[model samples]
Target: MSVLIEVVTDVAADPGVVFDLELDVDMHTASLRGSGERATTGSGRRRLQLGDEVTFHARHLGLPWRMTSRVTAYDRPHRFVDEQTRGPFRSLHHEHLFAALPGGTRMTDRMSVTAPAGPLGAVVAHLVLAPYLRRLLRRRAAHVKQVAESAGGRR
Candidate 1:
């Protein structure tokens, strides 16, 4: 089974500014809502780029979980895509789509995931993981929109 979640918001700023902020790890980390390790800890290889691999240490469902993602595509000031190199899911493909809106950029995040355990895993994911992930992304997307829109996309 494939799982997808998305959210959209308007930013009253320049698209370039919004895009730059999204790519900045430090700037992005500052706005992330969570405790302790929510902020990135890795250095040297911290920058996001094609073929660059990063292990994100985070918590979900009140338990510690980690995601190892490989940057498969990085089109600056436009779009990027990442795939799970390791972690819980059998496969994960996350694509970021952006379009310049009237005043800013209309950003859409598309996430597709395939679980393990064949057919049975799909059911388990729909019942348990899907809801948790949906809520988690909703919170995350809101944070991103707030940061982007408040920073005035022109900055």
Candidate 2:
């Protein structure tokens, strides 16, 4: 089974700033420090661009995990998409979108992931992966919001 997760965050910063931060590998690693996430390949400390691929190593639920994703779509300051090329999941797709709001930017994250295994994995996807991913995304979003808001808004 596939699990879907949606998260929205409002930040007192320009959409472009938030969008750029979202693609910053250093910022991502910093935000996910608790998980010991690091970029093993591709734009390690750089900002990802079109066709850029990144492989991430992290630990979750006390287990080590690695995932490789490529930027499949890029529109800048608007939306971008990344799909898993290799990972523990059967499939994974993530989209990041930013829109200018009244006084800030509205960032939305959409993630769809399917676990490995058969029917048993479906249960785990629904019971474990879904909630775990949700929390991870929320933490990442909060970190991005703080960075964007503190970094100052730039068009």
Candidate that would win on TM-score: 2
Off-target runs (Cα >4 Å) in candidate 2 are 43-45
Worst 10 residues of 1 by lDDT: 35-44
Q: What lDDT, from 0 to 1, does candidate 1 have?
A: 0.69
CA RMSD of all predictions: 2.6, 1.4
TM-score of 1: 0.82
lDDT of 1 by residue, 51-130 (tens): 76667666666778777777788787688888898888999998876678777777766788888999999987888877
Model 2 lDDT tens row, 1-155: 79999999999999989999999888889989999998954655489998899999999999999999999999998999999999999999999999999878999999999999989999999999999999999999999998888777744
lDDT score, candidate 2, position 108:
97
